[model samples]
Target: MSTPLKRPYRRRNVAKLLARLHPKGITEPFAGGRSTAPERETALDIAGALGAAGQAGPAQRLAIHVLCLRWWPGLFEGPSRVVGYRSVAPTAPPPSMSRSMRCVAPCTPKPALARVPVERPAETAAFRALADLIGSRLAIRIERDRAAQDADLIRHLAAWVHGDARPNTSAAKGVADECLHDDLAARVLAPTFLASWARAVIAEYRNPNHCPSCHGYGERLQLTAVAGSRARVDVASCDHCIGQGVMPWSKKRRAQQLVIGEHPFRQYLNAYHEGALALLRELEHRGAILLLRHLGSDLAMDTE
Candidate 1:
């Protein structure tokens, strides 16, 4: 029978130290575990350190990143696959069981509203400050070739916007195919395109007719009774606006505001409104992807 080999004395000592340090087993020390409290505290410390080092933008980003990681860990992982499918046939519930499910009427989704882009200097400054944070902490670098291609594509798009804003019939089969088909490109350039689109919309269209009660604020403050027999001020959606800051204007009013005939105004408004809605939808859809990309870049830098 072969004798069992024992671990070296030095190795045993190191293992003992690690076991003492961890309390539990030292296997996969760096792997994700159930101890989220420590992670939260560590994240707070990192944010504080970054802030103290005069990296406010990075600190803010790190805080946001930590919050996202806590709330939506699945965002960093792959899509879940359905392991099995259920039977198509429906079964009757138990006789003793009470069915509490109610039939709810389906409602149409409201159309997105077109709005003027209000210039915010403070926001712009903060955005610029994030450039350094992204560059240094995230370590996201675009290749020269890729950067050039993007610039060229942006120039082409800008030229098209400056022109009659018509799709090239020779190249594109239809407006939908031309605009909505390129998902990756749309996601990558959503921010830039949305900014330009907003500016154009503001310049071309009239200001939205704001709600009278809320005065463009979607919510209102109301006093409500609490469990302690005390009233507290709570912010709620404005009843008059139905949570939308802007109210829909009549055709006549819209046409008068645009200083154009109703027929022409309708056609123009529809085109612009549809485009705005599409861009907004694209941004909303791709927002998570962008956040993940940034977070991944930051993590990659740290790992390196």
Candidate 2:
């Protein structure tokens, strides 16, 4: 009978070890097996992750890119809208898990050590910042685009301020109220605030949820290897989020969090509809002035 080949056994061993392969971003239980790249992320890292997560379309992506550039223009080089990351130093294993692990018996080719990207404060902030910028940009873009196409808002403004106050003389003190109305609407850019509801609407469009860590869900899947004689995949509670699902950026939880949430910037989102309608009615100015005032407080004025 032909003898069993030594190469085959070595190859089989390699295959077994690889069967339990854990790539970056995947949760593993080893104490220090995590990758350290995420500890100090450049802007490119955050943008790359965001691009990979998949936003709705180009406009949404542009909105987010602009927002990031606005917030931290110098954090990274290159366009935020694309995934071309600035060259980073080669990844090194974490201190505790730095020992080289390899198949003892020779195989055709050995498996390279896996690299895990750790999510640190800066990277987490980038994700949260991108989400906020995208949401706000979407709101303003849609509202203003729609308003630009419709003239009713301008007409109403003119109607409310229909005539100009005459100086009790022959000269027309102001252009016909219609002209003045269109001018005001143009100045306020159709007063996107009316679509103040657009903030929440666009947010919902993006399927905005709660905790960044778990996408608002409170638990994450923990993958464990079977202990004794066999290799099997088992599910366990995620110790990272403490099963709370939300990963907060703070002193205790320092490693880059895999989960995403809105805990950092949700307060910045504006919901005009939630405000008292009576307050809007109390404005003494004509429709044009009142509309402009409403839009002045917005963080999202230009949609381009």
Candidate 3:
């Protein structure tokens, strides 16, 4: 075919074309690097050079198609000689866009002794939800309670019941007190809900909540932060002496400090007696640790 006539660069399309094709490939156009004007200008310059040379054919058609698609992907694709441009080799096969399957090893089996025991429908739900939540949130496995003796429906149900129920209060004292073993008391005192106050207290005792910053863990905490900052990056100071690292109450011994005046209970109460009493009563009814904490302060004051 005779050298194709050179075509004028459409100033309007120059930018549009450059946007569609530059740095020449299927990569995304510069998100923020070079401005659209410069890219379009470059594209126009290239187009002008091409027209001067001659109309592009099969191979050249492919190049033009690629360049065009690079910028304006909306353009149609087909084999044909239109204007002075030719289509590239049939259409190269579309790139594979399939993603590979993710590989995850199956969980290891748990020992009979380490499994969690749960019984009853509610318990079963709790165990399953706990297990799944632990796996997702804590990135850890919570084995079935090991004490479960069977795998049958009855057995699984029993296991769920056991798992859902709170550990007996006797568990803390170690020896089961026959005198204190009234079934009514046990039922009344048993913890009832997940994330309940009882559960929070138990969890704190089991693992103790820790500060992500400064490795401080437990009830007492010292907080440290830059003076001007709103504590975005503050770290927990050692719970002792507000970051002194020496626990002020430690020297006095928690028991000794419990003697009322030795601690803040009486002083706090004298200053806010009704409020303190109301809070204490509320906390006691809730079975929270407030009694132990406040009673200690009260007794310490007496000793002083």
Task: Report per-prediction Cα RMSD to one decimal.
Answer: 25.6, 23.9, 34.1
Off-target runs (Cα >4 Å) in candidate 2 are 1-22, 29-140, 143-152, 163-304
Best to worst by TM-score, what's the order? 1, 2, 3
Output the better candidate (1/2) by lDDT. Answer: 1
Tens-digit lDDT string for candidate 1 (1-304): 5333222211212112223223343333212223323221233443343234333365444444332222223223343444444333224433342344322423433344444334322223333333233322211222232455455556556657789566454433332232322443334234553344333333222245668887654667789998997996766789997875556656565456444467644643434434443333233223323332342323223222
What tens-digit string does per-residue lDDT give for candidate 3 at 147-249? 1212233443454578975544443333222112344323322334212322222222223223433232222333456568644332233543343211112
The global Cα lDDT (0 to 1) of model 3 is 0.30
Model 3 scores a TM of 0.15
Clashing pairs in 1: none
Clashes of each: 0, 8, 34
In model 2, what lDDT does residue 219 have?
Answer: 42
**Which segments of model 3 are wrong by more than 4 Å?**
1-17, 20-43, 50-56, 77-304
Candidates' C-alpha lDDT? 0.39, 0.33, 0.30
lDDT of 2 by residue, 1-304 (tens): 6545333322222112212222232223211233444433233444453354226456444433433332233332333343233434446543332234424433334335554444322334544444454345544654564455345544444555755432322222222321223533343233343233332333232222235554433344445557777664433334655443333334112111212123321222222222211122121112212222232312113211
